[model samples]
Target: MPDLDPPKRSRWTLWLVLLVCAAPVVASYFSFYVLDLRGRAYGDLIQPTRDLPASLALTDLKGAPVAAVSLHGQWLLTYVPDRACDEGCERMLFMQRQLREMLGKDRDRLDKLVLVPDDVNLTPAQIDALTAHGAPATVLRAPRAAIEGWLMAAPGHRMGEHLFLVDPMGRWMLRTPATPEPSAVKKDLERLMRANAGWDKPGR
Candidate 1:
């Protein structure tokens, strides 16, 4: 007669493999939902989470139709700048870039989306500034009406005053400070990446 059950060592090995495989998913959920993230992080969790609408018309830097996947496939740190990239606006833009870069090896999992009103175009100087910073030449633009309806701001703050944290599902989840310390923002992002490491990877 042959033994039907596996040996004890084999059973333990199987359990170990299962745990290793599931570690990422468990850690990710714990990092996001169960942890006391607010005490030490920069994210402001959005109540009644707002997801970006696919029907909303979007245009890319090339004046080409924007793909729906671009908005939702990766973790996004977004900002809305006025028509003119003033000194303050540039500073914010710089911060956004620097913060993403601070992610180091995990940087690819994050993206920068600058939302601009449809009625405005970037001046040559504005383009040059963004270019000098190695920013995408043709940034994405969305209708002002849509931005107002879709994104929420903190009390007494307008759309242009804060950075948005959108989840990979395209849901708007967090509202960051208008002017955040790069190191502080990096910490927040690192926590998020750690929490989601099991499920999230670099790239869309």
Candidate 2:
């Protein structure tokens, strides 16, 4: 009959070629996720790099569309609050601004984002107040459900209870505690900028 022996050396060579082609990708994944190499992070990893859902949209104070994509390429310090601006919301806003300022020169590398969940209507005087207290933050009005997709509650906590951190690539990276101490949060921000120095800079 025809050769009953296997393809022998040719089959072995083909298997070797396939393994060689996949080596780099496999090694990178191992080094990054499995092996926990030196540069690997201890921080929580958000898979798939969540983006602003397409169904979500925002409007500026002037009633113009504010594209969610505008947030890309800058480190974002985000807060979710209502237009009514209660005492708790006001305190959170102050903390967000102060935390950015505490970054020193690195402050320019970050942007403050306030996601208002409804069209509660801000009077011109109220707008003036927000601007006066550095509240002219990149305000965007989105549905409460859409905002919840990214900013989640911790255990019994709620979304508006804490400040969220998003990296330049638009990945939700860190979540500061509800009762965040400014000095402690400042250290965390500085650490992030320092670690990402290779890819990020101190401005837009």
Per-residue alpha-carbon lDDT of candidate 2 for residues 48-137, written as tens digits (9 for 90 to 100): 446655456777766688777777778889887644666777788788888888887888889888777874555566456556664356
TM-score of each: 0.79, 0.70
Sequence-dependent TM-score of model 2:
0.70
Task: List the lowest-lDDT window of 10 residues for candidate 1.
Answer: 129-138
Error of 2 at 147 (Å): 0.8
- Once model 2 is optimally superposed onto the true structure by TM-score, how far is the C-alpha of residue 130 displaced, in angstroms? 3.3
Q: Model 1 off-target regions past 4 Å? A: 1-27, 128-138
Clash number for each model: 3, 0
